[model samples]
Target chain A: MGEILVKEKEIVAPGDVLASGMDYIPTDGAFRDGENIVSSLLGLVYIKGRLIKVLPLNGVYIPKKDDVVIGRVSDMTYSSWFVDVGYAYDAVLSLKDASSDYIERGADLTTYFNIDDFIIAKVLKVNKSMAIDLTMKGPGLRKITRGTVITITPQKVPRVVGKMGSMVSLIKENTGCQIVAGQNGRIWINGTVPDMERLAVKAIKFIEQNAHKSGLTEMVKTMLSKEAKK
Target chain B: MSYNKRFDGRKFTETRPMKAKTGVVKNAVGSAMFQIGKTRAIAAVYGPRELHPKHLQDPSSGRLRCHYNMMAFSGSGDRVRPGPSRRSKEISYVTELALSPVLDLSAFPKTVVDVFIELVQTDAGTRCAGICAASMALADAGLKMKDLVCAVSVGLVGGTPVVDLNYEEEAYEEGAVDIPIAMTPRDGKFSLLQLDGDLSKEDFEKALALAKDACQKIYEVQKNALKERYVEDKK
Candidate 1:
């Protein structure tokens, strides 16, 4: 029982060669059998007649519970404010849950978080009700006043963050950027200057491409030091 | 008639057969029945337990799994071609995306909550129906959440924002366009938006406004269904 190789968005009209190497259908969906395939690894599935294929799950922000994500205050209500972390749901930072500090009656929580003010928080839960609650009570949860936030595959966030936060820590040490990791697969990399931001982005992307391998700390430290020199 | 109406003799913006039921499954931790007109979707929730394969187990933040499916005969004239279609798979993806913000996966480690959504009949807006049903199902499953998420698609036909479109209205070749939005009305935040086609930013804003209005009504329906289920459970 061998695997098959199906192309990405291959146009197979009629008796076209949908796959090669193996006669059997791939158990995984991104690539499929001659027919009747599902992109099992989270993506958009498109079908024509009986044949189906997939477009890989793109974008950096896929949703997950307890993912410490970063976002901006898009809108506010009496009870909660909508934090647009670029996931399907705008994370709700409720009045009671936003912080440890007591919010008095009629005290505009807006002072704490105004529209477009960036922030970092942890996802508490996603109910069948689809309500996303957030709390700023984690080691990295806080307000991101300024800098840059780059989106990457939520699946690759671990790689971007590196083992035990080594990769992120190095970037902070070298570039002086504050980074926040969201569980839903979003990262807020805030560097003081454009160059630092660029360096941070480059480092994150490096982790993304080579996340499967080991010894990423030395690799990232070397990469950032080299970029800083240039 | 001062204004024209649809096939069901309802105003363009008027919703159809909006009914909601809950507790359809006893085994499920939570469950809900959500319908927009004739389209019906059943959602159920389970877990907060060890996600096996074991290696994926994290000490912090439990895993979340979601499935959006349609019954074989969910459509009027067509037998639903099963086994995770792309549309349904995307539904599963967005369904997961729409809820992660509220799930609090960090509090529970090594546990996973699985949400399953099945459409018994689909006219239009099945994804939104599944999302709405799934949210209620989580509640029935006894999962804690900040609040409910209500999703609805408002299309623009004749440049007007029509709340909740049926299959015919959706497939119609002529007329204006529409957009789908998932939101939590209690807070003015959007969950999911599968808006395609073309529209000025203005039309897009109006569609969002219409979706917000529709979600408010949907929020009440979602609460009532959960309340009824809990009330019945006691009985």
Candidate 2:
């Protein structure tokens, strides 16, 4: 049997041994060196069954295929729009992939999406060159209007969404806010009341600060309830 | 036995007073300002983001780039130049090499982590201080590394090996030898080693031992700075 070295939620530096033996499998943020599984980054260790992985505490977003992301329209060409998905290279959204309606060649593409417009889209493809293609024709993917968009470290998105999105759903249920978290670290919160919107944003910030701590869902629950009474 | 015992009135093996703080640059992803006696350097870390100038991007691993600069007003007496000089370029390359070993570059494919170090004040040990501050800034930016790199300068003055030579002591005419060494304190692995002037083989061994001890002390200061940013104060 493989022996687990570090406890769950423990902060580990790169090269710190996390486990030892053949019974355990190393995942992301971990690499096997001889008989030991070592962490490859400074992060929190997570163990489930026989698998171990580390969650990075800080890093920029690397967009993967099929990831739903929130992006800003930066530039528009003759038939396509360039979107800034918080990556090194801007993603391309062609006219055909942007909308269901037929777009004539050389049509005014800006009419469909203008510069600085917030968009909710999905990654269509990511080539080896890091060139990305985006599509807005999927469910929950469209142009965002009249909402506040906030950016946090993309690595913390999983924590903000929680297991099955329990944490975000709690915030929505309490404040009646429409919250959308992008895998690219951008979050959109639209609430009926400005006060609720502010509260949702504050809650998200709290998640960003304390993402490594366990029992965060309960903490957020209490915090939202306390703020609701106020 | 020579000029006024020691200019700074410190023991041969004693280091200068030091202070370090993290997150000093509000806009940088991670930053640190460190001072060792009169020498001060500030470092800021950006990225793990996409590498621009597409041709330089490494497909299999992340690339770390460092820029070391000395402000015009940082040097005493005469003002220094404003742009990159050959001396600064060499220091920047060595500093990057000193820090790259600790980082997990393979984990961040095709991305680049940039470190900018500015020598805000000079006192003959600027390179050592710059390397020390850069490591702290990298940790502050949440870059996962095996260990933090800490460094100290050992100089031979008046036939005695001294730690952290000041500008005056560095100018000693009696066979002055300056050596800046950087290492990972957790495992005592040397990351950087450069020498100026000459030293006897025995003296070189002694200086390396002294530098190892001084770097351990510097490591404590670096560790505390990061802890202050992330860990809660007990009191």
Judging by lDDT against the true structure, name the best candidate.
2
lDDT of 1 by residue, B43-87 (tens): 877765447777977666777789999899889887888788888
lDDT of 1 by residue, A1-230 (tens): 33233444332111122344343343323344234232322222344443444332222244468777778899999878899875434778887777778778888777888898888888887664345778777786788877777766565676666679776787788888777776555677776688888888888878765553457678787887788788
Candidate 2 positional error at A161, Å: 1.7
Whole-model lDDT per candidate: 0.68, 0.87
TM-score of chain B of each: 0.91, 0.96
TM-score of chain B of 2: 0.96
Please compute and give the TM-score of the first chain of candidate 2 against the native first chain: 0.94
**Model 2: which docking level applies?**
acceptable
DockQ of every predicted complex: 0.01, 0.36
| Runs of candidate 2 exceeding 4 Å displacement | A1-5, A15-25, A33-36, B2-11, B49-62, B73-81, B104-111, B144-147, B185-189, B233-235
